[model samples]
Target: MGGIVLVNVPTSKPLPIMTDTLQPMLRMLWFLLHGILPLAAEATYLIATYYSDDVCSSSYAYQVHAVDVVNCTSLTCSNGEMSSTSRSGDVESTECSTDYVANMTSTLSDSSYIIVLRFEDNNCSTLYYGYGTTELGECVENKYQGGYSISTLNKDGSADLEHFTDSSCSVAYASETANSSAVATHECSSSKYVWYTGSAQEFASNSNGDAGTSFSSDGDVGTSSLGSSHNMNRGGEYDFPPPSRDSSSSDARALTLVSVVFSCIVFVLVAVIIVLYRRLNRQTPVETRSGLWDDDTITATRIPRTKISIKKLLCRGAFGEVYSGVFNRQQVAVKMLLPATRSNLQHVNEFLTEAKMTAMMDHPHIVYYVGVAWDSLSDLCVVLEFMEGGDLRTLLNKYEAERHPVGIDRQKATIALHICHALTYLHSLSSPVIHRDLKSRNVLLNHSMTAKLTDFGISRERLDRTMTAGVGTSLWMAPEVMLGERYGVKADIFSLGVVLSELDVHTLPYAQVKKQCRETEGPRARLWS
Candidate 1:
């Protein structure tokens, strides 16, 4: 009866709709319009305007200030009595009859005007205009000397200032009352505008461009004069107003910044994943072929790291080719089996049998089967093991060439000792075993001349004192077996004796045995008596 084998074939699944090409196309579009280039341009524009000498240059740097106002109902206190505290830990106050709510200053220049207003965290909404004055000559020498200052709000209520200019501004103020605070009915005037000549001395000395009043008869503020403001309902107590939006380019700027940050995070994550994958594969078990083609393609059935990577073929045989390689950080030889010879059942059986049988044994003289991996895709793999020296046949030929050759006396004794140990173990099996084709080529060696018997494909097991396999190399056959006679363990002893006789004459026992067996007569010689 034949042994059973189970084959697992993978099922076919449908491929995804989004192919490889489409992914790159989408990425390219994202880079072109929304990536680093756009972000860089936006940053450059913002920096140039922010560093410009005319507007509030101090606005570019954020700072904190707190103002404590006691018993104040309106922001119209002229006595300047409110206490002011700054992030620098400086506090200032003055004696006055009335207290004002708050005052924080971002000085544009010595004489330039500042417009202070609070912005919502959304960056697109404003709560309400708290207090601001562009009043020209009334500019305080030290902006916080009056002791009234605006307290720094949290991220939800931070303030930013924008310069009202001839080229840029039209001022519109909106107010809301919250927390039952009473509105002051005093007729408040709008802030003034003036041209500051970049110096305290110049600003103080010159009276030319300072405005006498808030706006001369409410004339359009700038040359274009198309500025507009709108209010939206928010919680009924507070009104939300649209921020001074930076004209259509703000979205482009913000989107570009986000994309660049996202891309960089993805790139770093991919690099880490690749490193971990390499480490995992190196530590995985070895069960594959281990050879490399001349074209740099590796053909390894097993994974083995050697001192040096192999790059050439050494020899070929019925099983496959053997290649030079390294193993365990030492110079060793690797045998890579060819694909299964499915046309010949015996060859396939030999290959399968070698892997199964040797995988169980672990001895220095016996060839080691490291492990095995089956590749369902290619249906082939290279088995790996250690090889110290070449086969015994190659070593003997080399010894013959050296002239200080291996003598028959030592050769026979050594071969007998090693073969005896291997066969004795195989024969003493619960069912006695036979090595159907034993030859010099099948005997391998190590650097210390240790011998190992291998190649047991055609071997059979005996049951109940009876064996019925007609197999074996003819030259090593016993005389009785050659005459169509059934034989048992005695046949193996007979073959060993023939091997022993060859050591005496330094000649092969069955050199003419095949020809003699065809003689149309009884057996001619007692070659294995």
Candidate 2:
């Protein structure tokens, strides 16, 4: 499976019944009126407006098209399209759908507005936009003529910039230019026209110079007018209200907002109730995906930090620290991210990936993972079965120091075989996992000396060439991995042989291998000499 993907496709709208020559006919009519009327000497002109989206025509510096998933295959997968969520991005569109609720704030990486189309635990679509962390001042948008400045030469009437004055095309705004042939350029408030375009774009100007349908006086002006109140129902598109039905449309929009907000609150309450019910009933979260839990799966196994009791620190690592701890009255190892590392998003993502990988293992030869616990992101930690026998490296050093026979024995062979079992399970998965950093230090031994593999910090699935970033201890890393080339299951096998060599020599690799050869072959030996 290619995980899950959602594709956004544009919607289609047909032009209201009109012949192809109608546009040219309207142009000729305007020229004839300009030629005949003396009103052109001192006139008011409403710059012709078109219903099309040009990037700069709106105040938004960045646009996010949120792919709306009306019907999901599952929480992880969907197929649909996103309407642009700019405050005015959809005002001119022919259709709108508000089936899903959206929430936004200007607090992301770019310091811009972020609107998310959320489903289950997944944020299906993310949009970052608006004026770079700066809050828009009231009436400030008028400076940009509706916070949307147009400099485009695609002048099929680029803006819905309505200018009326004493002219033949008498409208509410005015421009200095009298002749229809003169370039008419004017800037107006963002509230100009809620028009439609493309093949669906059509207009019949009456005596009043009203090109399209007249908008209601009681319509949302722009981003500033909507404020923060309607975020719950600020969905795909806004329907333009009819002139006379202004009161009714406002009421309808208000009702829609109210109802959608209520639904969202109810959904949140239901989700809370479900979580409480599960916690109250002590329902154990079952493992899924055969040892490769994702974000959702990891969330299922989440426990509050209050349930964990730290005993003592076991070891320190690059980005995290492991502590011997107690959870649900069982001895466990709690691996927590360092306080300094928690603020880095990349580190946090890796920690979560490690949590998911740890939670997915279900084999006896692999370190048993307990639930993860956190009160907040700052206290994030994963619980695993604690090993009383420490790591293999310490055990080997002990035997070598005591002057005991330090070669491959029954116990060492058994340890090697147990590691093989773990590796076999990992490599045989549906999406084969590679233990990229396999070494003696990562192999844990319990009180009974039963070995299980641990430390999945850099392990990865062999789904593609992108999994080539894993480099463990340089001495133990396979040549292909060290060379940064694409490698597979055999890369781990190479590391396994290195481990077996450790069992035979009870020493670290490379340096000691030649030393042993020198002792065995004598000073006169060609290679060792």
Candidate 3:
């Protein structure tokens, strides 16, 4: 029998055992025939074969026997077992090896496209240990495994590469981007693992067949590559330094300090402003007093001292002088109490009472009380709407100067009617007002010759329709008022009648009474009567 030979065995099953006498004979027969037959190839080799797309399925396939690799145009081998050939045509192969690596690069016969494939096992069953590509710069399969078997597809161009020690690509050990025909290896000092340990190792390449390095865990290394000047140490270890902080960190710290300092300065300025405002408010005294009238009554407005500008003296009386002033840029009549009147508490109270009462009245025929103010010396001042036509007394005097007889009876009737309207409005109030003093002088005329009742100095709120004492011009006073009896709105009616007489007759009330007393030549009892 030809030399007993052991061949094609399966590792998953148990091997058949031979007797001691048979084993010696088989050993002797193998020694005798070893020189005669070609020595069995000790190392595994890669052979490229040809097939159609339907046979390969774009995946690695293997055969138990040697394949006719000469029919294939492209091939790659490890440990110098086989050599590479020029890649051309659609050279596909299903033959593969389980104990060695397979690398193939081929151009399609139908198109100008090229394909690259790498396998880790001879049978090419485990896809996790292989790499394949149809485009350049595109990711290679099974790149998570640290490997260095990267090359150009036809020596087209150079590539840049970086080797990371960790799966996350956070720890880089070597980097380069040069076209290398020979395989390059790298070792990590931290792990003591060689990056090119496996025959199936490969690097990602660009469209120009230039191999490059990837730094991210997802294998997107970007287009740009590192310089080829960087050396990839073979078997030697290298330490990767930690990242260092730049000047930007110092600039950020400086900016933070400036912001804090500026904020502190602003806080100090605000605090100072608040203190000054409080101090100024304290230094300025309050110029107004509240509760001058009943709670339910309309209150008078208080005018600031600076707002009143006395232009000239309009008139003067025993109580005070009236001055023409500009209040809030509008012409106003300001009546200031005399020093003598200010000295008397009764007169001062009466002045304030007049202001309060006038302010409450809203009738058109009643003079509008603008506001009240106080001088620097604390003297009371009352402001009223300026009547351009002056008082009825002045109007009558002008008529007499012009010899116009004060127009027709209609003019007198109108004046009387306006006065009556004002009186009616006062009496109709919830707290009826009593105008104790009613005369031609107290009736003011505006530019339109409209009559407005004024001078509320002696006016009082009379809800009971009675008063204890008589108060008014004696000539206009009624007989019952002169007798000091309790009177009511009837007293104001009597004053209104006297005012109407003055308007119609164009003469003062009881002017004839003074003349009669002066001309009296009879008994004293007649003068009394």
Q: What do the candidate models score in CA lDDT, each in turn?
A: 0.39, 0.51, 0.51
RMSD of each: 40.5, 28.1, 52.0
lDDT of 2 by residue, 1-529 (tens): 2532434545586432222333444455445444434321221111111112333232322322222221112111111111111243322211122321111121111211212121221121111111111121111111111222111111232212222211111112221111111112111112221111110111112222333333213222111111111111122222222111234544655565556545654654564555555655778645445232246778799887998998766665545778888998999999987543565567777888888887888999999988887776677889999999999877876777787696778999999999999999999999889888888889999999999999998888888844567577766888888888878889899999999988888766764554576578773222300
Superposed Cα deviation of residue 465, candidate 1 (Å): 3.0
TM-score of 2: 0.43
Candidate ordering by lDDT (highest first): 3, 2, 1
Off by over 4 Å in 3: 1-300, 375-377, 406-408, 516-529
Ranking by TM-score: 2, 3, 1
lDDT of 3 at 309: 91
lDDT of 1 by residue, 449-491 (tens): 7778765556666654745555665657776667656777777
Estimate the lDDT of model 2. Answer: 0.51
Q: Name the regions of candidate 1 deviating beyond 4 angstroms.
A: 1-311, 327-333, 336-349, 362-364, 377-385, 398-408, 480-485, 512-529
Residue 167 in candidate 1, Cα distance off native in Å: 99
